[model samples]
Target chain A: MAGSLLIELDRVEKTYVQAGVDTRVLRGVSLAVGRGEFVALQGPSGSGKSTLLHILGLLERPTAGRYLLSGEDVSGFADDRLSELRNRHFGFVFQSFYLIPYASALENVLLPGLYGPESRRSLEHRAQELLARVGLADRASFKPSQLSGGQQQRVAIARALINQPAVIFADEPTGQLDSATSAEIMQLLADICTQGASIVMVTHDEETAAFAQRRIRILDGRILDNGGPGPAEG
Target chain B: MRRALRLLPRVAGFALDAVLAYRLRSAFVILAVALGIAALTVIVTSIDGANRKALEIVDMFGHDAVFLLGGDIESRAVGKRTLTLTWDDARTIRQSIPGAYLAVPMRAKSNITARFGSRNFDLPVVVGTTEGYAQVWNWPLSEGRDFTAEDVAHGAKVGLIGDTVAQELFGDRSPVGQIVFLGSLPVQIVGRLSYRGLSGGGGSVDDRIAIPLTTLAQRFNLDRKYFRAIRVKFHNPEFMDAHVENLRSLLRHLHRIAPDQPDDFTILTADQILQFLAMLRGGLVAFLGLTAGGAILVGGFVLANLFSISVAERTTEIGLRKALGAATWAITAQILAEAAMLTLAGALLGMALGMGLGQALSRLGILEIQFSMKVFAIAVASALAIAAIFGLRPARHAAGLDPVQALRRSEG
Candidate 1:
């Protein structure tokens, strides 16, 4: 797959107002992600890493500045249009897996496609293919509660790719997994990137950041470093 | 296109799946809705059926028929008035009003005992004119025949017994041409009347015996000018109002009453009875409507409580769905759909239970029960409306959740 620019953020800012006091989270942050790139965001707790990820994933609108996704300026897009763009062009994975507990693994994977106008049969087929790609083909009918944490995260990843989006935004995707499962999930994400799907992951762990082709560290809502010489000898 | 239509079932299945997730809670909510709807159904149907039955009784009396009863119109008075309507008045009304079809003079005596081979039963005795009597009342004869003009001219000692009277006096034996002693008069039973069943109030009209007016007057020594009441039937049913006004004028002239004085006689017609029933049905429907509305309000409260709790329980899920590209409207639609599904299911169950209860009650001789499509449609529509109205706030709350805060809260 050809690598190209997929997301561009220019002078983005997010402010939190509580009790008549405004606290700026992201201060004029600018960033860009190329297609099929494996990028990692590294930051400590309360460093606005998650907020930046949310803005990039189209889940939150910046208080100021422009966000362009796949050459379309989405700064003034309505909620519905933003959602449509997200569903069509991007996918999401979270640290907690966030699978709907009452739904089966297959159903959790099929959730993103449900809002679209796709037929049920086609949606199911796509969900099954993604689950099989995640190596959980036999566990499609099992509820999230019945699956292990690692397996649930894998289903979440499968859900993220069900729409065949151009980019995947993973917020601490392996934060809740064991080291062995974490490595396996990182390898799986890397494999997806190799298959032409870009990924932007947020993580605090240096070892998790090492799996990415590029790494950026954020501090106080500002980029402290970008494209560093890998994970500090760890 | 056909495939999309077929997918409706899939959507419905998902809705059902969501409802069944909390089995006990959903069941309780549905049960509450069902109970309210059922009560509403039975009450409305029974009252409507009773009103219809009352109208049928008025129709059985005759078309365009009016009753002249003695009463004080301005004040409520106790005991019967002594001012009687005479047989002469019946003749006068028949001759004076060209629109009059038949005028029959009637007198009634209650609780008269009849003896037949030591079997005795208390029955009502109705004495009326021999000519145009059956025509004016529209009474159908089940056996034998009705009294003719010859019976009145000769003052014959013959009588007709109703179904209930025949059953009591003769049981299975044929009552035609049999001698039944009516207060030691020993009147011969000439015919047996058909069963007209109950007249809305569940009182059988068949438990009465009819005798010729001339025979009754002669046997009891009652004067011709001192009869009980006069029943007038009009030539055309549509001219009942005009005929009633004409009667009022004629009575005012005959009784020598002043213009300011209220007439001593009251004119009663089937339309008046119909109007009374219409008022009664309207009152009943309104009462049922209020009750059903209150029940739906309670259901709405329950749904609001349920949705509020659901929003709290699924906060993280809402965040996750939003992150997965779910719009605010999509999230809201999901919650609202769940509520509507629950309410619709409850309404269907309630309608079934209500109709069943109504049928059982009717069989037990309680209120008369009926089923109406309009009522069922209203019940279901109200249920959906209640769900939507009450489910809005919680749905909006769920949709407006911040993905970052929701995720952080869930982890914490």
Candidate 2:
């Protein structure tokens, strides 16, 4: 992994309240990822690993604390501003592979560019290239329903790279795939890291975590070391 | 805004896909909208057609003409008893009024039978009138000539039959040289009145006969002194209301009636009939409009509720888009545009459906149905407005959704 810091979180916390009971999901968790790095967040069920990824990805705002992207504090950023950052600076892949079912794989891949700040006419070629890179170039016209789980995940990965986002937040990217397909997806992730994009992946499987150059472990909503994870190897 | 504009196609695409995906639900919403708009189109077109027909009547009846009848046509109160108004009154009004008016006295009896050779048909009506009858009614002759003043003065037994009467009496042959007997009196057909389908007053004007006034008076012994009605025409129509008031006063004075009592004779005019018809159609449209409006209200609410449910069902899809960088307004715009498209489709379909229904009603001789362009725009605009207006709250609800919460809900 390269050295310059790209994302830094200082004492981030998230609390969920339900029917008058407060459950703290992530408590005083600090983390950072350098440019062109591959890191995996490993945890058991309800260990707040996914929540941490969500906050890091700007899809969520921590209940308390500061977050910085490229060393600029963005923890209290407005929703629309955060959303723009999410589109330009980050990409996300969920376990369920939320590719719009009715849209063709190519159309889903073009989604990020379509909503970005400028014309996306050029993104069409970029989307096709990303699909080819993910090895689903021939299936571009196929809808999500027509594609297998592995194929759908690849499409999601292609979609994440459409805007050339700085960091990719993948939450259990291979959770629904069989072992063979899962291995293929991890190798794709490794290739993406080598392409100079940072990746912060959450996974409970140690084998999935092995694909990353570094690993951080969380339990019961708290970091086990450094009171957090950092850009350096944890 | 530029980014939102760029995503416009995708937003439209996604909405359309959702509509197609939930076919049954979308259809129900569309059905509600279609039914309401269909009703609106039919009623509006019918009223518009009816108003146009009334205008046609005004055209036929002549804008400058007024009818003074001895019978009660103004109100429901009536007795078919003979009137005291005579030919003398008609002569008086014609000579006394300085407005270049024409007063033609008319005497009529209905359901009289006429015989030509061995063939006989029941006449819808028989009118005993003077030489100016054709000119006063603006009725043109299709064949032969109208009865001259000499025929009226000499008590000539000459009849001017309408085209319909001519058809019944002489088949395809022209009836000009033929003799037809009205009861025991034989009369030669002097001319044929052109076909006029419907009259402004009421029934078909082409199904009756006109004869010399003196001939009818002397033969039927229908009091030579009296006239059943006087058809009045003015050279200038703009003075119509003033002329009506003047005639009322003149008639009242001639009859020696008190100021408080209702006039013994009733006057009818093309404009009055037009106004009455307009009022009748106005009430009908208002009632139908309110009913259709209620339907629109119910349909709009149903569509709104359905859209809200759709937003709920697609919460995950919405969250995904927001995560991909769609803003609040972008989401709202997508839903609003979808609603507009849905209602517009329904409106177009409903109009097509309404045309068929309106034509069916027209075939039944209810009212001549014609679609006016103005009404078409209004009907379509109204439906789209309802759907768009009611769709806003649901769109706002969807736009206000928290992305993380929505994502969680979908995943769960």
Candidate 3:
């Protein structure tokens, strides 16, 4: 374990037995994410990029091998304990934004704070600031239904940052956005990285990966290289 | 505890928002609960009122009052349904029965037609009674004087009218001194009887006309010696058991009945009526309780099914919350709280409706209604129990959702 590493995975393997057929999703993948570094994980569809991201985010546990978060062997932790760790140490942003359809933008942003340490008043203030940061201050009361795809993604990013976590796991943050909107979201992620937050993002786009400080490529449930220039062309 | 206290309002607010989101479903839930609560409220008030009415009957009739109802009139193949215990038995009971104050005998006929000038009416009851009839029956006059002993002694053609009959016969104008015909006989109205509403038999208590016993025998061509019933009042009610025995013995002796024979008449007192009413109330309460329980069960089933469907439908949202660090308990509490809020609102609505309906019925004298905190407590407790018993299964289903699987399913 290195002192600079925020997330370290060692020989992690995940297998599913669906309908009595073995489908190994992650094959002994090992990876390390440093503190204050944006690491883009790139692979084509069915390349297990999202599986690796989910394992890093503590959303799923590997069938075999160790997962360490900030130097703690948390692979065997209980669901409740893992949930706490996820809340205190990690955040997530999804491709579809995953904003609560019934909640306003402000409420969506303040959601993580509800499960974290922030008081309601502080959460409110923080939510307001984050909405402003995302340039959706005037639309804070708008619901996810009323927002465009780009705006919804921005709210998701604001929510991800609300808990002030060590790392964020983004599974295709701009997968549904136009190139211009994608560029804007990449710029926001770069800014967040500069402010001392680590990110492990899953994307197939080379340009989306270009925003990261380093790149990792996975194929056929195996990591090809931890520091790849980019995923192999094809 | 402190943390839960803080979370309470948030949980409630979130639940309220979710409920408002699915307005149509929530409305149906509320309606189901409202019906259950309404049934409970009405049942409680109705039973309470029945008990109160039994007490009121005791107060109205007084403990010392007793009525001698003719028995075996139809069973004996009697020609005219004539009284078996005649005027001789009435006299014997008055003379020999201890603590006897008044022994007023009466002859009453039902569905008699009466006319006053051009106005015609079919009166429900026509009572032939002596001078003390008003006092014996606890029917006091509202206006005008009572028929005196002189009127009865002379077999006077005077009628004491109930308020309902008076109103029908004379309108707003007082019926005192107005002459009305009972069949072919003309009788002058002397007194207006107070309105007593309905009897236990559901007949109009205030729709009868009373005339002197002698007048009824002479003018209506009725036998003077036989009366339909004898009503007696005692000096002290505590000795009612002894007087009742004495009266029965004296009546049997006067009728020349053997010791083993069943008396030809039945005795009714305020105490006996109270016992009968108490039994009636117990049966009524049991029936209402079963019915209310069934209603609540059905209502709870509706709620449970709706919430179960809701939980199954909102798996993605629940997963999102879990991903946001909401524990299983937190999700369950929120669901249960939503259910409680719904039932509470419906219970309050039902209480309001029940109170309004109960008050209206009471005011109309259709039924007496009573309320107490016990009723409210039962209603609320039932609603909460229904919510909890029914809400738990769905909440558990929600709590059992896996975030990753739930999110993926939603996405797919």
Candidate 4:
């Protein structure tokens, strides 16, 4: 890593138990994402790529392994502490752009700030600024149902950045968008990364993965290669 | 803690949005809660009215006075006046009981037509009593002088009219010295009694025409040997119990009743009146309580089931919130806030509905229901308690959902 490390996974493993059967989801996986680094995890379906993304996002716990954020091991943190860390230091974007259907674009962007220590006035101003940044300033009052899929994803992206997290975990952030919209969203993610927020994105599309500076390939819950950092392919 | 406080308004806003989004589900729960709270409000008002009526009766009937009705209190049927007591019984009770200072014998008939000129008022109670009736009952003539000893002794056809009768037949004119017909017998109004608002039975106490006992008996051809009731006043209210016992035994001796035989006459004091009122209140409370409880249980059940369905439907939303860094308690608080808001809306609706219904009943003379701040407070508190009890399970379910699984489930 050329910069200060933001996320480090060491021999991370996950197992799920259902009806007296132990199903191993993730085998030993090791990876590192540095400050302002844009890394993409690429794999086929059932390759445990999504599961690894979940662990990295703190949405799930690794059954056995050490997970470090900013070089501090957080595998043993309590659920509440983990939740606080998630609120203060981590952001997420989903393929479906999970915006609250009842809330407007501006309200959705302000969601993460509600859980943090930010004042309402400042949070509201930041949300409007982010909406402008995502080029949805005019549609800030539009609801999810009223907005297009691309616009909804932009709102989700703005929401992720509200808390100024250290890392943005995006799982197929452009899966539902057209090729043109996907490129736009990926370019926006690259721009956010260059602004000093690290991004660890999960995508199976080669074209989407090519937008990142580095690509990590996962198969059968293990990382096959952590690619060398270089200029992203156009 | 501080973060939760800061998030309160946002969470409340989100909860309100969720409630508004599921209009039909929210309506069902709100309606159920409204009906339950309305029932509670009616019961609370009725109980308050009954207590107030009891107090009014006690105030009028006097603390040192005892009512002796001719009928047996337990077997007394409505409309059939018992004639076991008499003027002689009143005289004997006054002379024999040491502490009993005054006893006034009276006979009364309801719905009697009282007429002055061509104007007539029906439902006016016609009371036949002696000269001492006013003094013993602690009532004085508001306009004219009370009947003298000569009026009772000579069986003079003089009478006293109450405020209602005076207003009805005489308008604003003074009723004193005016002749009024009690059924067929014409009598001059010697006095006008003061205003007495409402009776315990919700009937106006002022719609009465009091006449001399001897004259009423002679004109109506009623048995002079027997009368309807007696008002006994004690010299000291402190020894009321002892005085009542003495009068009871004296009456028993005079009536020549055996020890085993039940007394035909019933003695009712202020305490007995309160006890009777309490008994009526107990039955009313139990019956109304069951209805209110059933409504509340059904309401709570509907609220719980609907909340569960709401949670299940919003699973993805819950996951999205968690992914956005909402803690478990935050999610729970949001759901609970939704429930609380719905219940509060229901309680307000119920209070309005109940007050409207209660006012209608009172106006129609069907029932008397009192509305007060206490009733509103109680109804709201009960509704909130129901929300807390029923909302917890669904809130906990929402809070316990794993964010990853929830999101994945939605994706599938």
Candidate 5:
């Protein structure tokens, strides 16, 4: 499945300098995600899982090593070019369901499209479609505060799909939800994966990681094990 | 550039949402800016009114006329009377000065009571002058005839009453051919002067009566040897300044004053009155202009501080926006758009407030405020400039925030 890889990381390294002390977050991390593949990064606290996700999602640049998206090296891209690529190709869902507190669910879903090439009139229609797909079409005009934890996460998922990105990067999408709601969110993510969009999710729970076909475990700043490939990784 | 243009409306909508979300903070900025803009508008409009009034005064006091007033105007104490000017001086200026077309000597008294057929009113002013007084002052009678030189030579009791006196003393009846007693003497009304609304000094210009100079001297018990002032009209108003200087030297020569001694009379022109008005306006401008500047500065300072605090408070939001693929320039543009919109609203409110006061002052006859599109343009441009100057720092700070660190801080 690596023959049609959507993303590739070759010895990526990230370092943070704080108070004259260097903290290595990701060291010599090499990974790849095939098109439509579901991958879960599992690690304990301080395992640098979130940092790796951020670098993969283009929110931050690695200190060294090459990052390839669609077989093209993008590690040396400028800030604006990187922003353009992220807008066109990547989506993110944070742990806190980071919807604009003042905006409605539909408005939150339309945010990504606002920065993309689509016109707002067309984006509105697509945002409604995405919200309906997430099964909260009736709550389109509700603010984030008015929704429950599971409902808010669903809205966040709808927003992540607004721009029709090639890959979705979700950082602990259900970390704050109960077991039952967490299972529901995982099922929704699984359903989305089946629709031909790759997903890279970070979680500490084994049950959550079970939803993904491949699980990559990390400790300290290095990958402990890249879980054996699933049937799609052939 | 094209992408930024397309994203402008979305960014502006985001900005408006933030502004609406924090209503209290937004109102604080709007109120501060509105007060400043209102004060500035009032001051600017008032200055415009003062300029218009000055022009009206110059227009009323005939552009080509030079008034030679009795008493040392530069040195005299207020209300102290002088009687050095005479008809002889008027004769000399009209005969000697090359450009002098006609010089009309005048004597005036205020608070005179006139009576006619049991109706009486306290007239504001009564003037006594020669036959050329009507022509030199450019005041044509609306009805009847002007008094001739023969009337002045004979000290005739005929006079021209102003519209106010005619209306007050005779109702709808014709004032001509009627006799109105001036104090204790009966004077015949020969004509009615035209209606003139208000004087530059804000008193009714139509409240005065005109009579022969000799009649005032004999009937009013004034000294026949001297008069109050002499108004000299020049043929060429373009060269009136030179004519005024020539008249001043000639008056000094005729009065036989030594070069060291100041003349007891003052020469006045429309320019002198306008200069006096400008000096008065200058004091008002300095005081009011400083006040306006201080208000604007305080308003800008408050806006800048509040924006900085808002940016600091929304760190997580900014991070989320960046994560959602918003560029650095988009964040900056959103903050700037918020500032511009708030100030624009404030400018409109301020204009309405100031114009309200302008209408009141205009009604009170204190000033005549000129309402024009220029004022609107100035207010808007200044508000946008303030938004640019004060809103830049906070917008840049928000745009420069590190997304990863911002998100981490919020996670706690």
Candidate 6:
């Protein structure tokens, strides 16, 4: 919070009500990531890693505590404003590689810029450049189904970079890939971080977590350790 | 604004592509909508045409025309009394009223048998005035001449036959200048009238025969002083209420009736006939409306079901769009646009089919089909409204989808 932190969570808590019963998901979670920091979150399933990621990504609001994005308190913001913040400031890559099946690889990569003021010509060029950076330029016109699993993940990575967001939130980016493909995706994500962008990846794979500059582990909705070596070779 | 407009066509194109992807199912839905619209259009147009035809029949008797009839038949029969209006009263109305144009005396006799050669038929024969009959009533002569003042003055034995009478008596032969027997008297057929076909009342005036008033009064031994009724044509139709009031006061003074007593004679005006026709048409329109409403409701159900299935099939697509930074409004707008586009397509196609069917019916001489602009507007507006009404819940369901659950479901 002292040095222009890009994200700050002040004792954030979330409780979900189902069937008239309250289940507490996050309990007083406080965290921050400064500009250009690659922070990896590692935890077992149901440890609230995904819940914390959702709150950080502005997809959900915490029931209690204040959340700030780039120094602006966003916890009480309206849905539209939160959506705008998510669009302008963050990119997401999911485990399922949620690319629109009907759109081509280039269209999928260029989809995020459609809501912004970017010209079609410029967006197309940027998408091509990103696809080439990910070494799938020739597969730009292929649909997600026509591409291999590794290639589809590559397209997802390229899409995550299309808006040039301040941070990319990759939740299990390599969960659906082989070891070699996982390594390739990790390398691509690390390269994106090197280009002065931040990344916050949530993965259970210790090897994948090791590629980040900082690794944090959580248990029972609370952080257990920080500044630990992950399983990935660095 | 320009970007939004550009997106409209793209969104519409996507909608069309989606519909085309399921060609058979979409086609069936479109056909269903079109059939409903066509039925509604035909009923509305046919009823409207019938109303117009009825009005035209009333207009044939002249504008602002009123028929003064004696005491109600049921009341007179029940009370065992005789009450009638006289020719003196008709003359008084013509002379005293400032707005009155023509006050023609009429004495109608029912169940008269007329004969031509070997053929014979029974029809209602109206014996009316000769001098002002054609002019006051605006009856057009299809063939030969109408009764002249000389004919009525001299009580000439000449007559005008309606199309139905001429057809029945003469068959294919021309009845003009021929002699037809009317109640033991041979009356020369001087003219034949054009067929004034069946009006909304289900009665045709073309089945009757018209003769001079003096001839029927003198020869047939009908009541001379007390004619059956007086037919008064007025100059202006809008002043009918004022004229009716004037006629009532004048009649009360002439008849010496008490102020509180009911009128012995009732005045029937074209306005009353028009009102009756209007009510009839309105009822028919309401019936058509109820049917159309049901059709639209069922169409809406079909649309809602289609949209629900569509949302189910595109859960993953909705999630993808959300993850790509699409606003909720944008997603909702896309689904609404698809519904509207489908309904609009159905409406246009339906209108075309309706007009075609109307034309076919017209060709068959069933009705004079008129394509009203108002009907077209209503059809299109209702189609769009139905789309919006039915499309809302499904579109909202699609828009409110949780991104995580949606993606997970798609993967599963």
- Highest-scoring model, DockQ: 4
lDDT of 2 by residue, B1-412 (tens): 6666667887787778777777877788878888788888888888888788888778777878888888565553655544657877887788777583688888887778999888887876889998878888898888888888899889999999988778888999999978999988899998999888774333567778889888888988788887788888887889988888877888888888897777878888897879988998888788878877887788799889999998898898888989877788888988887787778777887787878888998877765688878757977797779767889998998888988888889878
Q: Determine the backbone clash count of candidate 5.
A: 0
Give the per-residue lDDT of model 2 (tens digit) for A49-71. Answer: 98998888888889998888898
Clashes of each: 0, 0, 0, 0, 0, 3
> B90-142, model 6: which lDDT tens digit per residue?
77898998799788777776678989889997876656565676656677788
- Best candidate, TM-score-wise? 4
Evaluate residue B260 in candidate 4 and report its C-alpha lDDT on the 0 to 100 scale: 94
- Ranking 2 against 6 by lDDT, winner: 2
Looking at candidate 5 chain B, the ten consecutive residues that score lowest on lDDT are: B196-205
Q: How close to the true structure is residue B262 of candidate 3, measured as C-alpha lDDT?
A: 70
Q: Which 10 successive residues of model 3 chain B have the least lDDT summed? A: B73-82
Model 1 residue A47 distance off true place after TM-score fit, in angstroms: 0.6
* lDDT at B132, model 4: 79
TM-score (chain B) for model 1?
A: 0.85
Candidate 2 or 3, higher TM-score? 2
Once superposed on the true structure, which residue ranges of model 4 sit more than 4 Å away at CA? A1-3, A229-234, B75-81, B200-202
What TM-score does each model's chain B reach against the true chain B? Answer: 0.85, 0.88, 0.88, 0.94, 0.90, 0.80
Tens digits of per-residue lDDT for model 5 on B246-321? 9889888887879998777888899999999999999988987898788888888988999999998899999888
What is candidate 4's DockQ? 0.71
Q: For candidate 4, state the interface root-mean-square deviation in angstroms to 1 decimal.
A: 1.2
Write down the lDDT of every candidate, Cα atoms only. 0.80, 0.84, 0.84, 0.88, 0.87, 0.79
Candidate 3 residue runs with Cα over 4 Å from true position: A1-5, A8-32, A44-48, A61-78, A115-117, A219-224, A228-234, B72-82, B113-122, B144-147, B167-178, B197-202, B235-253, B256-260, B278-295, B348-379
lDDT of 3 at B195: 85
| Residue A172 error, candidate 6, Å | 2.1
Q: Check candidate 2 and list the clashing pairs.
A: none
Q: With candidate 6 superimposed using the best TM-score fit, by how many Å does residue B204's alpha carbon deviate from the native?
A: 6.4
Model 3 per-residue lDDT at A132: 91
